[model samples]
Target: MIAQKAGGEATLLPTPAILERLETKRAIEGDRTVSGVVQRARGAAAYLYSAGVADTSSVHVDSGYLTPDDMRSLVEKGAVGDVIGRYITAEGTIADPELDARTLGLGLDELRDAAMSILVIGGEAKHPIAHAIVQHGLCSVLVTDEHTARSLLDAAPDSTTSGEDPS
Candidate 1:
């Protein structure tokens, strides 16, 4: 694994195990059972993530690209953003946005909560999503091609220049 190559041990959280851990709660029957399952699974994932994040000194995330619309649809279930939805899980499976809430992946909040989120992404086609990620402060460190970096800076809102008066 990449962690081994980097001289670190990888902490693997298998999705099946995560779901299995919540299976008992999901055994309850009701009209809202499926929704409840989604909530429980999400909560379980969050708990595991919190434990991992809290114990770690740093985190390295290799995030994938989804158009802002796709990301919103996946995360918000079409309540906002584009109504049409497509999802790509962190494990790289393309799945129905509505049915794949249980897909194993890191949420935006989880990424931001990490002590360090080093985002690695680039490509002309990815510029928009990359820009959105940076604009939203999702990444504390970014590794990308020079062109993409320049584009990010160009699109950024103007701020006071270093060693200059704000007045």
Candidate 2:
């Protein structure tokens, strides 16, 4: 909400928009200390916290100053994807119950409602995460390299994509 209000769209960046991928809690705080990006994100989180929408102590992110300790917590609960917001699984489940309760961002349902959601990601490590968001219908479109794209399709099971039965 704050990023969008401050001229940031919901489009995914090439890097991991999710915090854990950016930092390991001791890895120099990943992208938080970067020049211009942190300001907007921290500002956003601050506003949300002030508005009682988020808890700053939960703001353990180093990527955009708005991390709610997203990745590790969710990954432990079988989360495959960590989008810009919260943790979601390929089955469209919320991986981390604790983080989910305190986050001040859009829900998966809300993200799906955005006019357009383009996910930009790459790497073998990111395959599972990307798969969850795409499988869950959170992203309207994916913006990844051919290798990762093929990887996602190859990993797919014989099942419906949009809740429609193949039969």
Candidate 3:
């Protein structure tokens, strides 16, 4: 909803987990027949996000589309979290594009320039992500449950030193 505050409408979508589940179910029921759905949705989203980034006219965060393999690769590469398709590193910088094809939406500049950035995701697993976002000043406001808040605070946070790993 931070986008609304910035005079833009928030376009909410299913989390990457949900999309992954759907894709898995479809795979179970059919196989590659349903995989095209992710591609179609991703292509359309990429187009829309390209415009958003160009115009500096919109903001969005989506997950649940990245497959387990995709997320695992990122995690292995020191990614703490992802938003709007872009990976956030431990130091709060977007992951380097060299790691993989960058996702659409909210480049670091776009995110920093926003009047306000809000993060509503949480979980023990999400602690590092929240920490990176907070330390990096990526989000001005955060909406999370008490348990998640506590966990995030309890988990020692790390400062992002650079956008990419030396490797």
- Candidate number achieving the greatest TM-score relative to the actual structure: 2
lDDT of 1 by residue, 41-97 (tens): 445322211111101121211122233344444434312111011132322233343
Over the stretch 66-165, how does candidate 3's per-residue lDDT look in tens digits?
A: 4455555666767765655566677866554643232432356555556655567655566666777666766667777787678766664433445646
Given candidate 1, what's the lDDT at residue 133?
58
What TM-score should be assigned to candidate 2? 0.52
Off by over 4 Å in 3: 1-67, 99-101, 155-167
Better TM-score candidate (1, 2): 2
The true-versus-predicted C-alpha distance at residue 166 of model 1, in Å, is 12
Pairs that collide, model 3: 15-63, 15-64, 16-63, 16-64, 16-65, 17-64, 91-160
Instruction: Supply candidate 1's per-residue lDDT for 33.
Output: 44
Kindly report which residue stretches of model 1 are placed more than 4 angstroms away from their true locations once superposed: 12-100, 160-167
lDDT (0 to 1) per candidate: 0.42, 0.53, 0.50
Model 2 over residues 53-155: C-alpha lDDT tens digits?
A: 1233323344353445534555556766555456566577776755554444345665567666666777766777677777777777677889889998888
Cα RMSD of all models vs. native, in order, equals 11.8, 11.6, 12.9
Worst 10 residues of 1 by lDDT: 51-60
Q: What is the TM-score of each candidate against the true structure?
A: 0.47, 0.52, 0.51
**lDDT (Cα, 0-100) at 32 in candidate 2:** 47
